[model samples]
Target chain A: MTDAIQDEIIREFDGLEWLDKYGLLIASAKKLEPMDEDSRTDENSISGCQSKVWIQSYKRDGKLNFNLDSDAMITKGIMALLLRVVNNRYPQEIANINLYFIEEIGLKSNLSPARSNGLESIIKRIKEIAKNEALKDNV
Target chain B: MTGFAKDFPILEQKVYGKQLVYLDNAATTQKPNSVIDTISDFYRTDYSNIHRGVHYLSERSSERYEEARKKISDFIGARNPGEVTFTAGTTDSINQVARSLEPSLKGNEVLVTGVEHHSNIVPWQMAGAKPRAIEMDEDCNLLLDSIDITKKTKLIAISHVSNVLGSVNDIKKITEIAKDHDVPVLVDAAQSIQHLPLDVKDIGCDFLAASGHKMYASTGVGVLYTSDRFSDLMPAKGGGGMVDKVSLEKTTYQEPPLRYEAGTPHIAGAISMGAAIDYMQKIGLDKIEKHESDVYSYARDRLLEMDNVTVYGNTDRMCGSISFNMDQIHHYDAGLIMDKMGVAVRTGHHCAQPLMKSFAIEGTVRASFALYNTKEDVDRLIEGIEKVEMMYT
Candidate 1:
């Protein structure tokens, strides 16, 4: 996809009034098939979550593309939100984005500390994939 | 009775201009005036370092401190006071046993029950011991026949009474099974020590651990009772009074109890625990047990009468606590509704997440009782449960 198309997709999400409005974002993300066991052989396991979550990032024409899947529904929504911010960006742009900014988005603010930790784990997984890709290019 | 209630200063406080009915006794019993007074007196009048001191205050403090150990031994029917080692609480006591037994355990296998608290399970796992939880029968009693005790089985750690389910395990039978396999057993008596009459000799367990706070004593005080035959086991942390002789060259450690108690002990806690034990002794444990059983039966019968209410554990015999869930409301919501009605019940997994997972439940609201709790308190709790049901249904 072109930068304009990506910006349009990002704008559609940013234009949403409430988090619940992005149920389509969560549904589309969940609908994306999980990477098979053979594909998730290593470097895809997300820690701190009670359920299994795998995030696979691939470089398409020097831009990051992420495919995420999680067993938990809420966690899948969180992963979707994370992908909207970090996916389909250049390695440098992805690295510049601070993961802690999720608290400002106010997703699952009422969740227990344990659930919040799981959300952070998903964010960290996305960051790890970006960092690994960034390292491969010597950035 | 009002005067007795006032003796607990916490009870005197008003939450929204209403009295606090602390029904979460199985979690931790409230301190009485006598126990509190004993603690304050130790800190104010008799504050001194105990043991290995030549000063007058130290000697006096040491005498009083060690006397508390004797009192605990007598209270629990332990053969010798030397078997009683001071710990932070029940968790610390269980962890100590798990750590000290590492040398004796060659293989990874350790037997435990499904009803054990996380404190009892996690420590053994941390020691690299593989824990096999014995399955509970239809009545929620631990099925000893299901336990596959092999030569690799190093230890059997079980709870005397489950904090969540309030189901009492047959410790004597469990210990006997461990004995047949020549494996030692550690009993987590955090819940039972307060309500039940415990005799270490009769139970024949290698180790028994209990928290003083659960028995109306001060917090931060607990006891670990070990058999004399296994007294040579070393403690996890070692320093100070635990050693016999310490020099730049080498250090010699003391005997069983002293070797385990390393730092300057909780003198006030120890003394207050002695007072608490004495208080319980005066009331008679048999009477307390009978009264608690009657309370459990009454609560269970009343709770069972309500539609869409499920009570967990063996109804035929339960001790201090009753764990139950409402029709469709979350446990947290139920807890909030109960709190609003001035009825305090514990919500969530009661630190027994595995038990929750077994039943495929998120959590339960547990209403636990104590000696001070009356039938009227149970009636208030029933009313609160009804309110919770009405709100969700």
Candidate 2:
């Protein structure tokens, strides 16, 4: 189940020190494959972030894929954590999942309110993309 | 005074299983128990509408409120109590001047230093006046020689101490320059009032603005000091309390201080602010200044010792703040890490976006000190920063 992936992320973060959560996020971000420059358009951009961030979604064979990037390394790291849970998953599953890893890992507590707001925006954008993909399948 | 941190009840607490080390004084200071008690005592005992009430509570409240203004008048060394207007903090106070001075500006530019908070800059811009920033030196000190106070300059505004750089400006010298140009100067004393013994007369600035919450008082209260020459202006906002006589055709406004204060004033906030001032006066500004300078220098020296850290501002005359950034580390990330370590510091542009742009940085982690902050707090900040760097490695 997709919950298993979430559990694994929670366990990994829980084992790290309170400060190391950011480092883990940074490392996750660094490991993420870079998005194509063409995908860095306004449609793929996430607003309300202090740092410029981009997220693109595509549907292939009933599975949704997401590519996230940010000018800020920490933000990119945060997006990578989200991508780990929901990327290459079914549209409905990606849309329905709560992504509790954010709350469970104490990421929100570590980040400023503005950063959290941006994180929320990123999640919302991801869900929006997934929901649209589901709507396209129905059509 | 060595153990003065005990006076702040909030400082004794813990955050995330660690002892809280609050160094974000530039944002606002934690109130002392005396200030807290004064506010509660006012509401519990003598809560009433000020100025026009015939009842005993009203008389007592009115007397206490005016007395508080007098205390503030003395605190900043303003010659007349009437010259000091109670506002809803520094932003509101500065806006009052902006609105009042706009029509008189007649399209002239408002000269402000680059180091001002947005509260100092946006007001002038909002008043339909363009703000011309006096550039800072490469070292981030205000470049006085670069200040061109021409005939087109309607007003010159500067912070007595920069919230970002913690740089204490030579207000007396700037005021002298303003005098030569026949331009009135406004000093935003929000950062300086808590750390320095401010005498408006000594500085010779035409106007000064300060906030109460930044000086160990309750929020929603501040003072605007107006010189005798420009003391009275038309009311920016008109309401029941500010008017002397009102008819359908016309209304006559009250004097300088009352004219500016509209609606039911913050009686409790003012009284509590007076108590906060009393608290500082008892400790003595000279002693507080000395303690703050010592902490600032200690923190700056410690931060400078770290090879990766780039500390901002000239330490020679700075007070109560140490703003810096570590190499290859975002200020927001460092701030978050510091928060986890129970060291509260300010991050982001600190409402000085222009100043940040000038420095070619997005932001810096700012650790601003107060009377309650000790050398130990600075050590925690240093430790928190080290932890941030270590995490990235």
Candidate 3:
């Protein structure tokens, strides 16, 4: 897949050490907008994650935008990267986007069933929403 | 690395360009080279089913497996080898007891401490019984005097040591209380068996459950100690090996331990546990206890001295695990950063959510100790904490 954002992430993480990658992620997590109290309800929270996470989404100009936040800064940093790639995109486009930077950047542990970090669950949730929205658009 | 650390080959490597300071012993311990080789040797020399085959290999396998049982029986002061039955793990062991006593436990209460792992709490609940907690003070000491164990209380299930806080419960005292009431006690020793010298006879408990993987042995094997007094408690499971005679109309069962272990068992895993017991005994449990105490005290003292850290559970006696959190950093965030620094500490509820609820916190960062751990590892952990603080500042 040819994704400029993913390629940029890959390049940024290419020469860095493990600690440096975590440091960068912490910085990015700090930059991500914090979710408000009303939006961080039980309805928006993702289950089966060690760190608590909430997701909020809306439609704007025929595109879906998501706001994701986590109590753990490292997870929130990954959420920031995820939003940078998938947010502000049409539903059909998001349904087909391939995430390759996760493997390239040595964050594959986050994708494991054992860790259950909610990264995979959140991605699956995002895709499900995109597909459902796309079906509605067709109807 | 220290003298004992060299015995565990997994500890010899580097992680993220630093020596691996393994602080997650409460979750599972790294196996020694002796244990690894024993498992391999058993698999190569005697790989046959036990107690059924008449061949030489089967006889050898059965003898070795029985020897393993005997070693474990002696290790926990089981009085006789017939009192110990091998189950999958501690969770399985507890579930077995729950299944056997389900009829009686359906509506009765099983008194438990506030700081029990889900393994001890969930099994009784699954058996259709209510698990009421024995109240403790703010310092997490068990307040034994206040519990109202009327006719409704059938059992008292307790943990010898809390998996999260390393807080050792006064189980002997609890057992005495249970004895006065004629209520049976089941001790969950998953967190204590590896670190402390255990004697089920000395503790005077009816049942004790423990896991193998947590004690430097292979997974998929554990010991469940059942007092001879309850030998006739209906076997939790019934299959080929546990029965004396099977018939279309009725089936009679074997006596005690063999009656409990039905179907094919994890023979190699059992032998590996025996080897692990030998490995620990060779160095002596007293020596292991002394070394671990020094390291644990040093770690706890250093963590307590840090003004930004909040260490949990201040019981009179503690070991194995110490739970804490930084002033502003999330436990998960601290754990991830510490992993990068090659310090492997477990961060989360540690499978004790009720305890977490009592602490009024989501989770904690736990750095647990084992025999192989040293003051050097504690220093490295402190360094990792400092690095995390520096990055955030």
Best by DockQ: 3
Ranking by lDDT: 3, 2, 1
Candidate order, TM-score descending: 3, 2, 1
- iRMSD per model? 9.4, 1.8, 0.8
- Please provide, for model 2 over B234-256, each residue's C-alpha lDDT reduced to its tens digit, 9 standing for 90 to 100: 77788988888999999998887
Question: Which portions of model 1 show Cα errors greater than 4 Å?
Answer: A1-139, B1-7
Candidate 3 local lDDT, B1-393, one digit each (tens): 667998999999999898999999999999999999999999899989999899999999999999999999999999899999999999999999999999999988899989999999898999999999999998899998886788989999999999999999988988898899999999999999999999999999999999999999999999899999999999998887999999999999999789999999999989999999999999999999999899999999999999899999999889999999998898998998999899999999999999999989999999999999999899999999999898787
Per-model TM-score versus the true fold: 0.76, 0.94, 0.98
Put down candidate 1 lDDT per residue, B1-393, tens digits, no spaces: 352355567766655345677789988998887888888888788879998788988988998888999999998889999999989999999888888887655358788888778998899888888888888776678777877898778999999988998888888998888888888989999999998899999999989999999999988989999999887787788888899889999888899789999999888888888999887777788877777777778888899898889988773456888899887555655675577677888877788988888888867889998877777778989988886665443
Q: Best by TM-score, which number?
A: 3
**Candidate 3 C-alpha error for residue B353, in Å:** 0.7
Candidates in order: C-alpha RMSD to true structure: 7.1, 2.4, 1.0
lDDT of each prediction vs. the true structure? Answer: 0.78, 0.86, 0.93
The structural similarity of chain B in model 1 to the true chain B, as TM-score, is: 0.96
Query: For model 1, which pairs clash?
Result: none
- The order of the candidates by DockQ, greatest first, is 3, 2, 1
